[model samples]
Target chain A: MVDKSILLDNKKFTVGIFDDSDKLLHAVNTLKEKGVKIFDCYTPFPVHHLDHALGYHRTNLTIGAFLCGLLGCLSGFTLAYYMNVVDWPMIIGGKPQDISVFTSFIPVMFELTILFTAFGMVIMFFARTRMIHGIKEDLLSRRQTDDHMVLAIDNDQDQSLSNKDILELLKKEGAIEVNDSKEAFNTSLTSEEELTKILKSNKTSTKKTKKK
Target chain B: MYTADIRQPLVTGGKTYSDVTKDVCRPIENKPTPSWWLGFSIAVVLLLVLAGTLAWTVWEGIGTWNVNKSVMWGWDITNFEFWVGIGHAGTLISAILLLFRQKWRMAINRSAEAMTIFAVFCAAIFPLFHMGRVWLGYWPLPLPNAFGSLWVNFNSPLLWDVFAISTYLSVSLVFWYLGLIPDIATVRDRATTKARKFWYGFFAMGWNGSAKSWGRYEVVALILAGISTPLVLSVHTIVSMDFATSVIPGWHTTIFPPYFVAGAIFSGFGMVLTLLLIARHVMNYQDYITTEHLEAMTKVILLTGSIVGLAYITEFVIAAYSGYEYEQYAFANRMFGPYAWAYWTMMFCNLVAPQVFWSKWARTTPWFIFIISIIVNIGMWFERFVIIVTSLHRDFLPSSWVMYHATWVEVGIFLGTFGLFFTCFFMFAKFLPVINMAEVKTIIKDKE
Candidate 1:
């Protein structure tokens, strides 16, 4: 049997960041031409056709929801039937464990169907996204949930021949910012003072030039 | 191939993203003028009078109201039915419009749903108070125990109503809360204080704008909306059955269900318009609840009003054609009997007045719509009164027939419900984001 490990570490990635979606698309196409395996695209809101652009398959959440709903309906029917028919058989309005019992149970069944589907699909979603409770999140940009877009490419260290060639290619393909995982992780670990100083100087110059 | 644009804007003049937030949130963020407070205070006083009357009613018992042995269900039932009918418009605007993908609902749905929940609460009070022993109201539930209260009659429309109303209220609350979570999250992000942040954060359920969360939320909303659409329809249909199941002359009609549903939608839309018109102006959310939203609601009002008018005519026609002397007499009596003034007032308010919206000016002007909505509300209440009282006042037996009048106690509780509705609404407006900030933001990136 093949080993199925939940905690598998993938290789480090290089990402060419673009503020504009069109430039991001062009960079993605260039990476595809160079046979680079892209990891995933992170966007604040859903961008049209990004899944197709990234060659990701359609999600299986809906299939999971449908199966859960089917199970729910069956369970609801079985529960109602057992309660009404086998356990305590009482007739109301001349209707008993015939078709009317099933009909009467329809609303409950519908409610259960929805409940199961929702619960099932949500669990599947959390599982797929690796969002377990107490697990720290890896953030690319704080504004990724607000207004920024990031395209990440997965680069295997052993397979890659030249770092200079990949950087040149990304820069040539109109990347506003080029970054590797190692550099980003290092930059992210600095104390608040040093980080704030660097950010402040960059912002002051940008503001001054914009004003002029 | 040229495709016809299914995605055309509903209104000619469309509002921008910031405009929507500004328009809807205006009421909460800005302080109302002295005049607004003055009007609100007047409503408050009327509500106080209603409260006093209810206390008196409780003290005096069911006999305090002028409902006699013959007219056991009087103004209280009428008011219950009327308020419940008014409650329907909110769900119709929120759930039905959402299902139909009418974008204009975005402007009015929040206030409308609030109206629905509050109106249902007010409607519930009448039946409980009218029951004499309001404390033991839970005896109606279908729980079996050593206490030998018989299981609730599944066949009884009233029992069905308990299930229907409770279910509707619970589901509506869930739907409303689910819709509100994102906006609550927005508030959480904006909160300056630790206490406010904690409270809003708890309600927001650790939402991080993750695609997974959004996906789950969307699915939940779609499913809830699906459930609520039919649930809202079934609620009023079941309420209408309270009369339709009865063998009374005017009340026993097959047309009552759809007719009542239409009337409910009409009254509901009227209430929605009433709230949104004032809310937009008071809140300074001109951009969110715009002219186009008002127009869409006006169209719904006009459509439902016509359906109700048709029902009115159909009832008269059916009574005449059936050759049932009692039914004909009841219909004739409503138009030309002791309560002729009330009947005519209802007709003029519900039927004739709504026709003014055929003109663009009547639909577009908020003040005009507001006045008309109030009239429609009055008309709907009278419609209930005319149906319940006139039908019961003169039944098959001539000797037992009598005149029924709502004593001051009955009148007080009815007015008090307005206090109940508005007070709850005012509080809701003051606290929560009256407009859904998240849903509005989703449409902000529309290419159109």
Candidate 2:
């Protein structure tokens, strides 16, 4: 199942834009030291320390890849075994059942092992990231994927620290732009019922509105 | 104050991070240049030739080329191996270099990977048609079907090739496209036309640079690179096995696997030089793919070329030491036989030519390296021809042996595959940034 992008559903975030990674790293560490929760941080490329600063754990993609590789090995080996040994066993040079029979089969086994690992890790990553077709992306700024670094913390659970305090903290720590963006984005994929109902409601409000 | 090292600045012209985006996306923003049109027109015309020649061959039958009583495998197979070897450099550059954390690859990986995909396509066409009845291609797959309830032979090295090449092509495509996601999103945002946004957006698949998304992207790229290293190595080794497993005197040898792998890389880097030298000149990517990058690639060409040269010496020495008459004759015929000129040409181009790289001036001079690269390309094709033709021309029986040369159809088909390869490359150039913009931006500042 794809993980839905639900970070923007809530209206309580202080989006701090930093020009430099060092400044962003410094701000994330300071906020963590003072027990402020970091919702997310985005950059064009990964920063070395920001994950650790945000208390994010290492991903289990390697583990998933290992398991998938094992699956591929078994699948490849079984196919070779069933086709050669079990089904039509044609004797090429009187070595059909030799002990080293599968030695020639290593290349196929190796290929599938790699093939499965690549497919598995990527699919698992896509699921976890919620990057599916037609899904609306919640972009803080277009430059976030180009040159900008963004730090966002949901201001919901920590009610004592107001948006003003977070803004002050961000500005003091050298964020180029600081603002509250609890505003919902035009993201949710509209359902057929929701679309038709909205059209009907609009028609009811306006008598001359054309509706089929 | 931040000052880049003068001798080895990763990027020149003092480009900023934003400049990286602007420079990479410039070709996409501007309309296609006149030179692009000239190249594209040539490529398109050549593609028509490839299609026409294939139609002619299939209609007239495989006998259109003189694969006769003795030499069953000819130019088609040589072309296949050559293209496959050429494709190897792309995956090697992007996957193996990435695993080693050589950041220099970021400048050239996109174009190189695209080349890999296209070259593999060109490689595949030969094998597909080499089987006389191209329509019955699926007969090789294991299933209970029309060719009786027969299954694919698991012991066959050719079967191993099918699995290896298809897997390599698919995985490389996935890796290349996944790496382009964020960069495509940048294109999507900067697009002025509605058509550009729609096309780029559809491919980008909503890849916002969220922390979670970026984290996942890194993990996947790392794993893909790790797997692709083994995949790329095994692919050419398995291709070599198609010859090595055969009992042909020259083809059967223990050193074929490693030597083939080394030669593949040697030849693959040569092709990369040929394409990149032209690309950097035409696309104005000099700042990103700087002189240092060219020097570094020349060093790789020298190293791999040396290994291949050593492999040639090793093969000849072993053949001489072995008392088998056929083995000794095969190597001798390869050197002093009718095709001796081809053999020496291969030697000069593959071994003696790359030695010029020892001089720093040769490596730094783009035009000189470009000339050497073309020579290396020619040498590699001759190497394949020498291996296939010379060995086949002299069988055990003197009466059965016959000297063979490529018919016009055979040469036309060979020339046409280049058309197919370059056409795809031209299309990729038109649509995408040839450099990995997102990754390059990270290294430009070096201010962490």
Candidate 3:
């Protein structure tokens, strides 16, 4: 029941498409209590406190930003000190170029700190999220990025809850549409310059099995 | 999930999530309208004028302009300061407002931040071309050079500006592009053509709207905003220091930092109003942009205008109170001297024009706000011109004083920058989503 041509492995998912974020949030809470090993949830925009419902840990991107910012600060200071003092020091406007005159370095220091922190944090974000240019998108539904909030549950992984049981739970929790799909998600992305081929060649088509 | 009862909906007409994407991406998906083509053509023509004038300046050397020995920095530095100040409002809206959790900014921040990036590009052109030897632009960097391994002066505010402006531009780009990814992904999903899908999907970077990605996205956005808030304030402060650190009687005032920053925000809002007023009407973004957004912007224009007005009065008072004859004469010359017309024009346009916003009707009216925005832009330009020229023309030695008038080349180059700015903006509007669709979706009132 899997599209072997596109997916890295054969795994079936019971996908639930909800129209409202509130309903999706509620369903995630209830499904977790029912011992459903939900894979992930997708939404058009960030829903308030929905991450808590999914039991997702708070992202440590702030820690990454701080570490990068600290690196930037030191680099800024070193660049200024080495150039102005240790390498070649010239007195301009009668102000001596020395460690005592650290105030003059403040502007460059501030700028470098910001420059590095922004770039570094963004790089960390892209790498951690595995987001980059020229990667094929593994989408459950075309409307997932538009209006629909989707919850993808790996029926193979969750021995506690059957596929039918999860689909029933999703509909009871206010999902507008339910589907038992095998070809929706792929763990391994095609590292391709073949973006043009995706429209004509890819075999995965998101077919909705039932409407609630 | 619910907005406060008293707070007006940021996105009007009860837009749905899909509606937000549809409304914003329509222009990009369809053929360019006649209006878009018309604006683009005009901008391109003006851009040609800039190219011609800059070519003349470079080929003919610095003598092409009418800047005299006494008035060394004429329109070049004035325009540089003006555009830089223009850029501040974008960051203020995007970074500062985001930090304050002002949701109204979500509708406007995307365009405002785009303005900031384009405005900086325009600002950078002035200083870079003003150097005359544009090929040697890399000389500003603190690199070991052929001239005896000499490094740039750390004490010089000019050098500080080189570091500040480049850093500002790069950081602003990073911030803006990060905000665009999710919205670009929305456009990617809706794209029908293979070419459109490839390009949009390329930039969208495989964004699957994962809740985990969004959580990290929030954290990164917050930290960037935190750093950018101070970065925005520091940029204008450094620009002001270009004048304040100098010993020239009029330019050497301690209040220049706060005053210049206020004027930057004032002029920036003015420009934002000018652009958005035209965009909302032509693009049919009234439901998203709304009169409420216009009014909130006018309030900012009003507040910053007052601060700038106060700075003007304080400068004059401080100059008069100081016992130094040169300082007193500088203030008197600006008021009653040869350039009195320019000075009074600044005072009236900046100080008096914005006082009309005290009325709620004036604040909400788009046409009236547009006019005031234009007037604010003009006044701020004059503010820079007055500060640069009046002080330099009649410094300590009266014998060396000479009047400066901008040559046609100077005027054309200044006008050409508008071409550069508009051309970039029009292309941005056509190719990319002008509104932040993702953020707007979050604020859409869910019709349960």
Candidate 4:
């Protein structure tokens, strides 16, 4: 069970694909209300309030940036001071090596602080997301990042809602398409009208065989 | 249902997510438009001219240009300052506006950032070529060289400029690329062919846009914005110092830093408007880059133009008050002197042209803004000239004074840089999503 979280859980996911963001939001609310465990949501762009509506706390990126900038400031000033005053004394306008020249140091120091924050934040983001070089991940639909919003539920697991019930709920909550899937591949869902036609044809064929 | 915000629809015309993708990605995915082909051809021809002129300058030494001993720094430095100034708008729009949470930037920031990178690239060519033996240009770097352990001087403003410009370019590139990754992933997903898939996928780095990943992307973006705001300010401040630290009366003033920065922003917005007006029309992206974007940008042009004009006036007043004969002559000779035409053209273009934005009609009209932007561009070049030449030509001794004119080669090199700028811009328009796909998606109205 632990090994089969998103992948390798054959025929497990009941998927709901949404065309409109509002419809996706409403579906998310209803799914949460129905006690269905939503596997994930895939959107082309970030839907506002989706994370908060899904019950996550705010990100701590600001605090980390502040600390990194402070470090940059310290290093930038110290290096400039060390290089200019202590290491090699340049006689500018007959003035000696004086700390008063720190006023001039502000621009370079400011640049370095910004430089450090940008690099640090990006590195942190990469490490946190595991979005490193050349990793393979599947998108639920080709248009998932363009137009469609997808909601996935693990139907194979024991939960408060059944797969059929979840599918019905998805259709009720304005999902444009609903299908069953396993291992990230869609198992196309037949419409109810088509299902009835198949059943009726099967009954007629059985009667013909009986007559024969 | 989420209110569609039809009153100020950022994406405009009831566009869906797929529509946004289709529009932004159209140029990249499809064949080149006729205008694109024509523009690229012209740019390539101009670029070849740039190559020939640059080759001649390098081979024949800096003497190919009309820069004499009196006016040692000529059109090259002026062009450098102008292009660098134009680059500032991109960073300001992307990073500073992002920090302020101005949502309108979503539509134009991608192209603006691209503009910044290209402008910086054009600006860099001057300093490198000015070094003559461009191969030895790495001497400014803080590498452990074998030449008697000669180290880069940290005290020199030139060295500071070396650090400042290099840092600005690299940071802006990373910020731009990072912004592109998710969109590239989208492109990767949309690609039908193996080659398309591989190239897009390579750039995308398998960005799945997981909830966690999206959250982290925001973190990185916000922090980069925080860092870039100051870096942008420092870049021009340091550029200003290249002249400020000098004893040259026109160049040395306490107000140079802020004045140069304001001028940079002013000129930058002009270029941004120039490009966006043409881009929106050619690519049919009017829905995204609406009239509203143009109006907003014109306001920036006005504000910065005023600050720059104020700086010009204050410099004149201060020059008169200094009681130094050299300083007094510099400002007096600038207006009523032989190069008075350059001085007034700079004044008319930089200070006078943007004043029309005070009228509502001028701000809203694309054609007007485009015209004004061209005027401002010309004005900025003249401003640099009036500052550099007017001060240099008239010295303490009567024998030392000499007038300078840019030879055809110098003019060609300047025009060629435009070729470099446009060629890069056209290529970017062809390959990258002209409008950022990932960010624009967020602004789409999905009424709750």
What are the per-residue Cα lDDT tens digits for candidate 4 across B1-448?
Answer: 3354554666677776766876776677667979999999999999999999999998999888898888988898999999999999998999999998777898899999999999999999998998888888888876646755445556679888987998899889989999988888877665654576667776676566655567667767877887789888989999999999999878778999999999999999999999999999898888888887888899999999999999999999998999988888889999999999999999999898899999999999989889999998889888888888898888777799899999999999999999999999999999888888878887776321
Per-residue lDDT, model 3, residue A16, is 91
TM-score of chain B in each prediction: 0.93, 0.97, 0.98, 0.97
The best candidate by lDDT is 3
Winner by DockQ = 3
lDDT for each residue of candidate 2 in A20-51, tens digit (9 for 90 to 100): 88899899888887777888897877776577
Error of 2 at A10 (Å): 5.5
Error of 4 at B281 (Å): 1.1
- The 10-residue segment of model 4 chain A with minimum total lDDT is A1-10
- Residue-level lDDT of model 2, residues B1-448, one tens digit each, is 2344554667776786666777677678767889999998998888888888888889989989888767888898999999999999989999999998787888888988999999999999998888877887777676666645567778899999999999999899989999888888877656555587567867777777766677667878888998999899899999999999999988999898888888888899899999999999987778888888899899999999999899889999999999999999999999999999989999999889999999999999999999999999998998899889988999899999898998888888888889999999988888997889888876775421
lDDT of each: 0.70, 0.83, 0.87, 0.81
Please report how far candidate 3 places residue B263 from its true position, in Å: 0.9
The CAPRI-style docking tier of model 1 reads incorrect
lDDT of 3 by residue, A45-124 (tens): 88888888888899887788888888888888898899889998888678778999899898988888898889999999
Worst 10 residues of 3 chain B by lDDT: B439-448
Weakest ten-residue segment in model 2 chain B by summed lDDT = B1-10
**Taking the tens digit of each residue's C-alpha lDDT, what string does model 3 give over B394-441?**
878879999999999999999999999999999999999999988888
